[model samples]
Target: LEGLAGELGIADRVSWLGFRRDVPELLAAADLFALASEEEAFPTALLEAMAARRPLIATRVGGVEEIVTPGTGRLVAAGDVEGLVAALSALVSDPESARRQAAAARARVEREFSTAAWLGRLDALYLDALGQRAQAPRVAAGERPA
Candidate 1:
């Protein structure tokens, strides 16, 4: 990352804070949050950004689309530099829209990704799995469980 920053002539503009414990504080202080991952699976960083009510710009890969909806954030195709640039530029130019999106992002996180929501979903999944197990036909005593 430092090498890339130097190549892009942004070394002075960027700070490389490796593995800090104050992630929430950092996100809270940001005007926007961007995740340029080529691939991801429901990244926790994205959720943390949403929880912090920061406007989000993320790649449309894996479960990202499920989190970053139209009013919540901007999603670009993975590796699409132009799309990412456009999203960031738009947010920078329109603070009202950005703030609205940030609020929406935070609301979505609270609605769908909160601790209570997660626990409820987990409990439901466990119950459904247990019910399915009970409904499955029993194998003979000498057979392996299937």
Candidate 2:
């Protein structure tokens, strides 16, 4: 809120934009992402931001640390305003660095969590489980497979 309003100098331009229908497109068009969270499970927001290839400026908590590594974005200590400010400043001062990080983040997602790769791995797991079940022999009332 304050960060967005003050940093961007658009206090009045900040609209709620609640439940936007084209969030994906907006994220894709974004230059950077800033998330301040203390706890999270999967932090799908970070994943979504990464999927959109935007450099993140997130607090070092939850799954954010995993998402914003050296190659992805700047991870600041939780509740560290100075750190956040520094990161924001550095990124703002050097857009090239942010662009590189964003590209690397997208590449990382493509390598680790791409939909095609995820589905292929799931298929392999199912096949392996099925094969194991098939190879196992049924047991009689008082006897088991040797």
Per-model TM against the reference? 0.83, 0.79
Candidate 1, residues 93-139, lDDT tens digits: the string is 99999999999999999989999889999999999999999999999
**Per-residue lDDT value at 24 in model 2:** 88
RMSD of each: 3.0, 3.5
Candidate 1 contains a number of clashing pairs equal to: 0
Q: Which candidate comes out best when scored by lDDT?
A: 1
User: Over 4 Å off in model 2, which ranges?
Assistant: 1-13, 134-138, 141-146
Q: What C-alpha lDDT values do all the predictions have?
A: 0.94, 0.83
Model 1 residue 92 CA deviation (Å) reads 1.3
- Can you tell me which runs of candidate 1 are displaced by over 4 Å? 126-146
Over 50-114, each residue of candidate 2 has an lDDT whose tens digit, in order, gives 88988788888867666667878888888898999999899889999988998898888887677
Clashes of each: 0, 0
Q: What TM-score does structure 1 among the candidates reach?
A: 0.83
